[model samples]
Target: MNFSQLQCFVALAETGSFTEAAYAVDLTQSAVSHALAALESELGVTLLERNRKGVVAISNAGQKIIPHVRALLASEAAIEQEARAARGLNVGKLRLGSIESIVSPALLAGVLTSFRTAYPDIEVVLFEGAMHEVGEWIEQSIIDIGFVVLPARGVESTLITTDEMNVLVPYGHRLYDRAAVTLDELYEEGFIMEKTQCMFRLMKRFGFELNKDKPSIRYQASDSATILAMVREGLGITLVPRTMLPKKLEGVVALPLDPPQPLKIGLAVKAQQTALRGTTLFVQTALSWAHEHALLQTVSS
Candidate 1:
């Protein structure tokens, strides 16, 4: 019935134990039990069945109540944030999830600098993660906004920017001599690619399936610098977003992929839902920055 009680119940359901749930919600075990009992008595239904082993949701009671509890908590938090913001002070936290490679020190520093200059009192929290993990964060409302590559299959977002995916190879590599390389041209070459959903979609776009067994997979890595480093050492070649490459990764050459296989970058928010004020501002700033800087337009193209 009460927000505190619902909080306790949700925590208990997630943790599967009274002790663990109490620790998670910062309450004592007896306090958590009391709250759950109060909530069930008010609803006239049992929410959880607990025993020596653990707790389980026995009926539709738990399922029916959870969404309500989650919504209530979210709104309550939003209210608090609104109250703080109404004081003419930017004091609430902003949770932004982004791909690790895209959030390099330079880009992050620039974004933070611009954000702080505008909203000096606002606190920004950055979460660096893989594209898949960041998507989950956005879906769960754990993050207010995210900078990710598209086409994200299920999320609704605005296209903030798009960067071309270029082949970075060693200076003397066979493909480097060509004015532009095609997917078929590199079909037999070794490739170091990011192991993400984007990679799969990109491969699908190229009409080729990635095979690890192709004797040419000389190196495998997730970071662009590492991939380029490996390429510099003649380990193998990689296809990376053009924005991700540092200006001075020595001994490496970036070439256009014929027909241009580009990585569409965008700011993803919770699809079809209202956004928080802070989140809205961040998304707007990001889009403005991308457009003003012509970040989406590739120099090579």
Candidate 2:
């Protein structure tokens, strides 16, 4: 059946009366009844039962068709919105997200400056959180898109850059005098680690086992600022992607590892969302920024 037929059917099912459904859709009661009759005939099932009281859901077939009708209505709305954006009349709040550590005033200002210059009328809102939290936001439709490090599961993404992980140490520390060091050198040192599942994947990549029984972990945190604070106080050292750092983070030094490892950063949206213009533009800006800075190469398909 046609989309208009499904719309009329769904409204009738929800309102439970032809008169009410007709008012809701701005159609006459006769038109609503005729559309529903046509739909029932096409599907070979009675979707509504009518009596002196009112119309009611008649069978399991009606319940099954309700979801499909909702999907069709949503798709139609998306098509209209996308068409408007394509015509250069884009106007809406763009929900955005990024890992908390990388939301520096300098970096954010630069990206916003560029985006606003292109789409000045679009309102942009940014949410900063840990990677997992950002991923959850994207999945739940709470945010349109997010920037996160990859080898991430449960979401689809377009890679923007790969950032080498660095060891953050106090400037006066003995290891600070060296050019680079191995992962084993920091094994016995008190370590500041991300207190999440990400820590395991990152450590595992370096051939290090994160056993809770070990006493190496001196502190745990969910954000990079606290990780830096701990390192600044000479409490311990932690691994972080270089892009997360701001200039003038006094007392802490970023040292490249002998066997360097990098974390992949990308723009990710819900894999099932077929219409997200703001998200698509944001990903393009992210990759363009990375390319201009020579920070990352384009991702091979």
Candidate 3:
């Protein structure tokens, strides 16, 4: 009838003695007898034959149901195994979103590597897009988690890192020697802009109202590589995250902005959705990675 009753019946049938069955099941002899009695009462059938020599035989019903009871115990064990695996972060699908910049294989490589090493059974799905697109995906429940620039509307976030926007000018540009330049100083220069909402917001934060007195937009593209290439060709200077640039600067020079416009980046998830086990593990792994790499920073929610 119940798991304990089934266990007691099986133990009693196998051992043929109440004392041994109780010892096998870690219950008192009286308790084991009570369980078998309850099981037989629920099924309206005798499960065992008691005698002066003890349970010398099992009833026909007990013989018939032994296999089924074993199967039920096996199923219960499997359920427990699956529950343990889920709690251990050994199984589940993690749907993660991120902007194109952070999705680069080289970026966050250590974090991804460590996470995969710790939880090899967890499947990780990465969706790459612009900041606004990633934010929309998280808000709509299309993904479990995402990495985006701070101030991601409609989601809770944990700060990962902060980087400042830098000016990328051609190698021989006149302002290349300057340690820093302001938005106004580059107002008249040919501006190669990356067509993303985050970039536009950063521009506005730096006092360059893109809608109002727009800079000379000589080139525009959604891809950072394309925008950087345009700058390399001397089409115009551009602004980009310092971390996004390559180590070897051949045709371009990156300079800090005089009044730096800082970009805060963090991992975000839907505010109301209960986070999955995989998602929680991933967030913890990312935060640990950020702390180890000195990328951790405090940011407003």
* Stretches of candidate 2 exceeding 4 Å from the true structure: 1-77, 102-106, 172-174, 193-201, 221-229, 295-301
Cα RMSD of predicted structure 2: 10.1
Where model 3 places Cα greater than 4 Å from the true spot, the runs are 1-89, 102-105, 295-301
What are the lDDT figures for the candidates, one per model? 0.72, 0.73, 0.76
lDDT of 2 by residue, 62-83 (tens): 8766765765664564566588
Q: 1-301 in candidate 3: lDDT tens per residue?
A: 6899988987898689999999978999999989998999999999899998775478888778776675565445445545866676367566788776534344467668888998888777777787878887776555678898877778899887777888899988989889999877876787877666456566775677764355767767887778888889988988778888887887889999888888888888775245565666788898788776663333421
Per-residue lDDT for 125 in model 1? 76
Q: Write the per-residue lDDT of candidate 1 for residues 116-191, one digit (tens) a residue.
A: 7887766787888877888887776656778777777656787776677677889899877777878777767876
Which candidate ranks first by lDDT, i.e. highest?
Answer: 3
Candidate No. with top TM-score: 1
Clashing pairs in 1: none
TM-score for predicted model 2 compared with the true structure: 0.64
lDDT of 2 at 280: 68
Sort the candidates on TM-score, descending order: 1, 3, 2
Of 2 and 3, the candidate ranking higher by TM-score: 3
Decreasing lDDT order of the candidates: 3, 2, 1
C-alpha positional error of residue 116 in candidate 3 after TM-score superposition, expressed in Å: 0.6
